[model samples]
Every structure is written in structure tokens, then in C-alpha cells.
Target: MKLIVQIPCLNEARDIAGVIQAVPRQIEGVDRVEVLVVDDGSSDGTAAVAAEAGADHVVINKKTLGLARTFQKGIATALSLGADIIVNTDGDGQYAGHSIADLVAPIVRGEADIVVGDRKPGDNTDFSASKRTLQRVGSTVVKTLASIDVPDAVSGFRAYSREAAMRTTVFTRFSYTTETLIAAGNSGMVVASVPVDTNAVTRPSRLFNSVRSFVLRQMVTIVRSYIMYRPLRAFMVLGFGMILIGLFPMVRFVYFYFTDGGAGHVQSLVIGGALLVCGYITCLVALLSDVVATNRRLEEEIITILRRMEHDEAARD
Candidate 1:
């Protein structure tokens, strides 16, 4: 198996080298293991240290494009290099390199298309207490919405097969680790989690409290991204909410309308009209959103299929 390990770095010169150096160079049945570093416009010597630590390849973006895009770029680079399995981990040394084999083994053995590393709270050292609790809660919420069960959704250490890398989208800039897992659940792919030990991350985290406003914003983005795949359901839920809200007014106006005529009738008519309008607007927007969403999904699928075909043709040569 050809495995390409990806490390997305941003101002990690302090610990990137150690992360790379710690990776085990060989795993059972794995003939090749290459390291690919994605530099997100870091001013520090992160790229330099990566090379020194024995990276097989590197891709540097002109500006700090954010973690999600940098991760996507890393996977693209690794795919171009013919990686059968892609493993992504932080450059901050939070995830132990020795745990990589455990992460990728499921994919190599065909037991799963995506292997996620779950940090059991108090069972691992790589996350702060605050991060662990929030991660567990976040995973629960996401699992409920996606109809998929996941143990740890915030873990950044994971492995993906070529099909997943080709099919999934890393669209968000914050809390992308969890968002990608949600995307996998919606993408008709099988996911598996591997338990691994990580020491508490020694660096400062970019994310804060789970109840913070920023966390809500990122979570909303993730939920909206998936709504593209289920516009009718989303609209129906919104419409139902509006209907429930209008019920009180509807009931009162109906009682008054039957007892009296002018003012009560007008009020009842206005309330009903408003509810109907809201329902109509939501239905319209859902329809429009679905059209655009379907187009984007089709384009993504076409490109992925062509890319896979090219890979097969090249292998034959």
C-alpha cells in the first residue's frame, strides 16, 4: 500500500519537525510512506524544517488560505503523487505519529473508506479538558443531525481512501475536522474510528468555548452546507415552524371571526395570508437552492470520476 501522510502547517516551526520526525517510517504491508507538507503562507521556517525532517513533497500556498483549503491542497498533492491512502494530522505534534498505522489500517484492509481518530476524554493526552468536552458534545449533535453515530468528531488525526478524498469537500475554514466527518456521513461512504492516545496538545488552540458565538457560527455553516443535499426537508422544517408560530393568532382570530365580522375577519385574513406567504417564500428558496446545489454536486462528481479514470490509465502505463 502507498500511504501519503499530510501535515497542514501554519506557524508551526516550533514543533513541525518533531511531528514529522516522529512518524513511523514503515508499517506492515505498506511498501511506501511519503510525507507531504501543506504550507499555509507561514512566515516561519515550517517548510524548511519539513524538508529537513524528510518530507517526500511540499505545496506552499501564497497566502494563509485557512486550514480546510490547506488540507484539501495537501490531499490533492498526495493524490497526484499516487497515494493510495491519505493520512492527515496536525503539525503541532498533538497527535502521535506512531498512531498512524492504527489510523490507516482500516482503509488498507478494506474495512472502511474513512478512518477517524477518536480521543476518548481523559483516556488521551492530546487535548485540553475544555476541548475534549466540547468535542464530545459536538459529535453528539452532529451524529443526531447526520443520522450517523460517531465517537469523537473533533479529532484532526484521520485517514481517507482515494475515493473519499475525491468525493468529499473541505469547505469550511474553522472546525473543519468535524465538518468533514459530517460531510462523509452525507456522501454515502462508510466511516470507522480508531482509538489512539495523544498527549495534551502543548500549543494554544485557535478554538475556544463550545458555547461561544464563533462556535455557533461555524456550526451553522456546517449545517447549511449539508442542507444543499436535503433542501425539501430543510424547507419543510422551516415551514412547519412558521405554521406553529401562526397557530395562536389563527385560533384566536377564528373565534373572533365567527362571533363578529369586520375587524376579526380582517385580522384572521392577515394572519393566514402572512403564514401562507412565509410558506411560499421558504418553498421557493428551497427550490432555487436545490437547483444550484444539485449543479455543484454534479460538477464535483464528474471531476472526481474523471480524475479517478486518469489515475487508472496512468497506472496501466
Candidate 2:
């Protein structure tokens, strides 16, 4: 089994070398280990630094793709290179490279399709109180949505089995951490998390400028992912609520109309009628959305099959 540890770097020249060197040269479960550096339009010569540090492969992106896209690209490149297992870590060396063995242990043992590294609380003492609280709250929300106990949902250090890698897809460009967990759960992949240590802060997070902004983007991503994965349930709840709300006013309007001879309740009748129409329309939209979601699942399955076939062909060559 070959393991490919990939790091997505954007102007990470300073820390890339140490990160690469810290990776284990020998592990019990794997036949070969290689490092892949994905340079995401880094003008700081990150690719050159990685190459000089003895990285096995370096994939360069001409334009700066966000972290999500860079991550996806690295996964694709790793797949093409016949990686049996893929481990992803930050290019800034925030995650302790030595802990990668523990991260991939579940995969090697066939216990999990994906394994996420859970950073212990206070691992990064530099994190603000609000940021820490948000991390906890966001992780709890992800656990609820994904139906899995992922304590560190935002941790970038993760490992994926070949099958899991092929089966996963990321829709949101904001971040892949939460979306991948949710997707894996929805797709019935075995997901697990292991406690791992992290290094000191090497640099500030480029993903978000402020806590409020991060929270806003994460909220959008979570809602979008929930809708994508469980459109029927989401729409059903929304449509049902709207129907109940519409019914309340309509019931009131009817009660008043019959009791008062429909004299001063014309506005109530109009408002109730409009709401009822909207409620029914919302239900109709739910059905359509469910159909589209089903099609999307089918498409993803097809893509997974194609990926496997391509990999098989490459192996034969």
C-alpha cells in the first residue's frame, strides 16, 4: 500500500521544509510513503522549496484557488498517482507531522474510510476565546448534521482510504472540513476521529479575516451542505412550518368572518389566502428540490465509478 501525504500550500515557503521533514519515513502499515506539495499560486517559491526538501511530487496551480479547491485538486492528483491512502495536513505545519501515523491507523486497520485528527483543546493557546467557543459550537453543529462525533470539525489533518477519497465530493468553496464529514456520513462511509497534537501557530489563518466573517461563511456552508444532502427533510420541515403558519391566520380569518358577518375581515382573508398559496408553492418546491438532489447523488455515484475505472487503467499501464 502506498501512502501520499499531501500539503496544500499558498505562500508557505517558510514552513514547508520543516513540515516535510517531520513526516515519518517509515510506518508499519505502508509499503511506500511519498509527499506531494500542491502549490496554490504561491509567489513565494513554495514549490521550489518543497522540491529542494525532497518532496516526491509538486503540483502547481497557476491561479490561487481557495483552500477547498486546492484540497480537491490535491486529492485528484494523489488519486492519479496511485495513492492507496491519502493524508492531508496544513502547509503551515500547524498539525504535528509525527501524529500522522495515528491519524491513518484506523484506515490501515479497515476500521474507517476516513479518519480526522482531533486537536485537543488548548493545543493552540493563541486562539482567542471567541474562536475557541465557535470551534466548539460549530463542531457540535456538525456532529448533529453529520450524525458523527467529530469534535474537531475544522481540523485540516485528515486521512482518507482510496475508496473514501473516490466517493467524497466538496460542493462549497469555503472549506472542505465540515462538508466532507457530512458527505461521508450521508454516503454511509465509516468515519472516525483520533486525538492528535498540533504544533504552535506558524502564521495567521488566511481562510477568514475575522471571527464574525468565519462564522458567517461557516453558517452558509453548513446550511448549503444540509440542503444539498437532505433536501427532502429540510424542505419538508420548512414547508410544513409555513403551512401551519398559514393555517393559523386562515383559521382566525374564518372564525372572525363567520362570527362578524365578514364585514371588517377582508384584509385578513386576503393575507391568509396569499400565505396559503405561498405555503402550497413551497411544498411544490420541496418536491422538485428532492428530485434534483436525487439526480445529484446518482451523478456522484457515476463519478466515483469513473474514477475507479481510470485508476484501474492507470495501474495496468
**Per-residue CA lDDT of candidate 1, range 13-91, in tens?**
8888888888888988688898899999889988988888788887788998888888888887777778889999998
Task: Give the top-scoring candidate (TM-score).
Answer: 2
| Candidate 2 residue pairs that clash | none
My TM-score estimates for the predictions, one after another, are: 0.90, 0.97
Q: What are the RMSD figures for all models against the true structure? A: 2.5, 1.2
The local lDDT score (0 to 100) that residue 58 gets in candidate 2 is 99
* Each prediction's whole-model lDDT (CA): 0.79, 0.89
Best by lDDT: 2
